[model samples]
Target: MTQTAQLSPSSVFVVSGGAKGITAECTIRLAQQQPCKFILLGRSELLETEPDYAQNSDESALKKCIMENLLSQGEKPTPMNVQKIYNKITSSREIKKTLAAIEKTGAKAEYISVDVTDTPALQEKLATAVQHLGPITGIIHGAGNLADKLIEKKTEQDFEKVYTAKVQGLENLLNCVNPNQLQHLVLFSSVTGFYGNPGQSDYAIANEILNKSAHIFKQSYPSCHVVAINWGAWDSGMVTAELKKVFQERKIEIIPVAVGAQMLVKEMDNTNHATAQVVIGSPLVPQATELDSELRTYRVRRQMTLEANPFLHDHTIAGSPVLPATCAMTWMINTCEQLYPGYKLFHHQNFKILKGITFNESLAKEHILEIEEISKVSFENVEVKATILSKNPEGKIHYHFSAQLNLQQKIPIARPYESINLEEDNIITTTGKAFYQNGGATLFHGPAFQEVTKVLNISPEKITTECLWQEISDKQQGQFPVQWINPYTIDLSMHALWIWTQHFHQEACLPGRVEKYEQFVATPHNKPFYVSCEVKAKTATSVIADFIIHDRQGQIYSRMLGAHAIIWSMKLLRS
Candidate 1:
C-alpha cells in the first residue's frame, strides 16, 4: 500500500480520540496532506488559548490527568484554579495548533468535546456534522483510555475507561452516521489485545473487539471501507518517559507519530483490496517470566466488558443480561491455555454459576468484567474465578458474578455443547429474530438478543438448534473479542427449549439459574456455530434442560448443565 493515498478535497472526516497522542498527530498530518474538513473530538474540553500555568514549571502530565479526573467528578472547576485548568489549557494549545495546521493546508477543522459512549450526545454531534460539513465520508475511530493494572487489582471503572471510547464509541459512530455514504472506518486498535499482556487484560480485550468489528462491519456495510490497525505503543502523547522505558524493556518498539499517520493514509486506500485488519508494530510474546510478583501466584487474571463486548448487553432475563456459566469457563480455560499452550481444556469439575453475572447497562457505565485465578495450578489441572468488580468512591472493591472453574486433563470428549457438525443443507434454518420479535420481548430480548440461527431438531425428549453468532448490526452493538456467543446468547439459546415446550406447555419459560456449566474449549467470534438442548427434568412450576455451543468441525466451545427455568407470562407480537 502506498503511503501517498491522501483524501480528496470534498472529503469530510469525523475522528474520536483525536485530541492528543498519536491521534492528534495524525489529525494534523492528514489535514496537511488531504486538506479535508475534519471534526476532532476529545473527552476533555479545551479552550482557544493556553493558560498561565502552561508556562509554569509545575505543570506535569500526571497533574493534568489528576485535575481532569477531579473535574470529571465535578469538584467545582474554575480558570482561577490554574492547577485544575493548566492540563486542559495545554491540551487546548495542542488542539489549536493542529486545527491551525489543518487550516493552513486550505482545510476546515473544528473541535467538539464529547464522550463517544454517550449515544445521545454522539447523535447530536452527528447532526452537527451533517449541518456543517455535510455527509460524513470518513470516520477514524481513534478513541481509547488507559487503565493498566493486574487483572485482580483492576476495577470495573478501569475497564470502562478503556472500552467506552473504543468499543461503544465505534457502535455509536456506526449507528449515528450514514453507513451507506461512509467510505472509511479506521479503528485504532492495539497489539496487546491480539497477543496477551500481564496487566493489560482490559486493554487487550478492548482492542481485540475492534479487530473483529472491522471484519464484521465490512461484511455488514459493503459500501464502507473499514479496517482496524492493531498499533504498537507510540513515542508521543500517551507514552510517558517512564512508560517508554518499560515498553523498551518489554521488546516493544515505539511507532513514530509521523509514520503512523502515513500508515492511516495507506490503509484508507483499501491497500489489500479487502476490508482487512493489520498490526503495525510487534510486542514480545507473553511469558511466565514477565509476570510481576503480584500476578505470579499461578493465578491469571483477564478483564472484559460491553464496550468491546456489546453482545453481553443482548441476552436479558426479566430485563438484564446475565453471564452464562459457559462464558466463565471459556475465560478460565483460555487463561489456562495461555499458561499451558498446545493443550485445550481436557476436563472441568465443580463448575457452578454461583450467581448470574448481570451485564446491566446502567451498572456497566462504571464497571467491567474481571476473571482471576484464585488457586495455583495442580499438575495437569487449574482453577479460576470470574467477577464484575469495581471500586467505590472510598476506594474499596465492589464485586459480582462470583463463580469457580476447575481445569484438568485426560478426560472423555463426549459431552454437551460438543457435537458433530450438522451440514447446513440438512439443518432447518430459521431466524431467531422472528421468534423474539414474534414473541418474548418480555423475555427481555430485542433483535440484538436473538441468538438462534437454525433449528436442527425438536421432539418431546430432545431439541436442537444452531446459536450461530451472525453479528447483528442493528439497534445496539457488541464487542468483537468473542468467538462464541456470550452468556446472554447461551441463555437466550435455551429459549429454543422453551419454544419447543410451546408444543405442550403453551407458555414461555425463563432460565431460573444454572445448576452447572463449564467451557470445553475457547471459541472465536467470527466462526459459524450451533447449540443442542436435551430435556433433563420437568415439573409443575419449572423445567431443567442441558445445552451446548459448538462449531461445524464439532469443536465444542461451551456447554451448559441443568439449566433451570420457570414459567413466565409474556405478551407476544407478530408481523
Candidate 2:
C-alpha cells in the first residue's frame, strides 16, 4: 500500500540585532533559504527620519570613493546590494515601505523597535509579529552590547550596561517565544565568553551569561533546541571606526566582515543543542592561536611517561605515572588552547592524581616458580615441556637437565646445571626457574644473567609452546609538573609544525618533545653546566634528533612495560 506523507509547516524566523552587519545578512539569508516569514527587531530605525540624515556627508563621500576605486580597478560598480537592504531597512518612512521591499524578495518582513529587555513591550511586539506573519519556528537572538574594559577598572555601571542588553534582553526574548511554535533558538555569544580577554570584561561576562542561559533553557525544555554561538570580533557597526581605534591601540584586531558572518551563519544553520559554542574566525578552525594571544590562561602544556619488572607479579603491569596529572593537564591545555595560544608566561595552576595496585609478588609466585612447576603445568589434559637453549650460528641448541624426585604428570623438564657457572657457561640461575599466574608464566634468570645475551643463550627451545607469557606486573610510576619559562614555546611550535606538516609532509603530525637539556661548559680549571634544546629547525632533517623520535615502536613497548611494572607494584603493595 502506498502512503501519502504530510509536510511539516515551514519555519518562521525572527531575528534580533538586524542592524548589525553579520547578524542582518545572516537573518536575511536564513529567510531566503527557508521561505519563512521574518521579523527584524532592533533598537535603531530601519528608515532614516529625514532624507538628509539618511545620506551622511561622510557616507556619501565614502560611496563616491568606493565607486571611483571600482572604476579604477576596471570593474563595473553595480549599486551595492548591502546599500539596498540598508535603504530598505532605514529609508522607509513607515513599516509599509520595509514590508514592500521584503515582499520583493519573496518573503514577508516586519520591524519592531521595542527594547527587548522591556518584557511587556517585547511580548506585545512578538504577538503583533506573529499575527502579521505566522508562527515563529526559529529565532536568532543577536542583540547585545560590546562594552570592553578591564575587570579591575570596569565600573558597576559598565557591567550593568552590557548585561542589560545581553542577558536581560535574551531572557525577555526567550520568554516571548511560544515553545509549541519555536523549534530552534540561536543565541549570539562571543569568543570573549569562552576565553576572557583583557579590556573586555563587561563584554565577556555578558556573553558568558548568555551562553549559560542557553544551557539552562535547554535543560528546562528538552524539546527546544538552544545554541550559543561564540563569535570572534567582526567588521560591523559594533566595531565602528571609533571602537576600532580603541581596539587597535590595545593591540586587538577585529575579524574580516565576510568571514565572520559566514562562520556565524554556518554555525546557526548547523547547530541545535543547549550551550553549543561555535567560533567565528580563521584561527579557530585550525586552532585558536590568535584568540589565545589575548587570553593568557588558555595557553598550557601536557606530558606523560610510564617502568616494570615482568617477574614481580605474573609479569603484568599497565599504567602511566603521569596519567592523572596528564589528564588534568590535557583538560587545562585543551581549554586554554581553544581560547588563547599567544599569551606567554601567565601563571595559574590546577592539579590532580590517582594510583592503584591490583596484584602482589606472593600471588605471582603461587602459580609461577621453578622449571619443575612449569614442566608439570597443564591447562586441560595436554602435557607441557620446558627446555632451555643457547644461540648458535646454525640456530638455538637445546639443553637437557632435571629436577628431583616425584613425577605425577607426563610432562617433561629440561634444566641445565644445578647451579649456573658464569666462568664456563656464562649463565646465571635464580632460585625460582619458572612460575605461572594470571594466564602467563614467568622465568627468572638471577643477577648472574642480567644482560640480554645471557638470558637469550638460555632461552626456551619452543618459547610459545612452553608457556603463555603476558604483560608483567610490579612497575614504577611517576609524573612531572612542567612549567614553561616562555609559554609561547608550545603555541609557536604547534603553529610551525602545522604549517610544515601541511606544506611539506601532507601527513599526520606526531607530538614532538619540548625539552631543555643540560650541557657542561669547561675551561682550563673551571667547568660550568647549563641546559638547552634547539627549538627551531631550518630543515626537517635538522629536526629529526631534537623534535622527532625514530624508534617510536620501541619507545611504546618500553612504556607498556613500565605501565605493567607500576600496576604490578601497586598490586603487590595492596596484597
What TM-score does candidate 1 reach? 0.48
Q: Alpha carbon lDDT of residue 479, candidate 2? A: 23
Angstrom error of the Cα, residue 136, model 1: value is 0.7
Model 2 lDDT per residue over 399-448, tens place: 22111111121222223212221232223221122221222112112221
- The parts of candidate 1 lying over 4 Å away from their true place are 1-6, 49-82, 290-337, 340-575
Provide the lDDT at 279 for model 1. 84
Error of 2 at 120 (Å): 2.1
- Counting only residues 3 or more apart in sequence or on different chains, how many pairs clash (N, Cα, C under 3 Å) in candidate 1? 11
- Model 1 over residues 26-58: C-alpha lDDT tens digits? 877777767888888888777755443345434
Instruction: Give me the displacement of residue 225 in model 1, in angstroms.
Output: 1.3
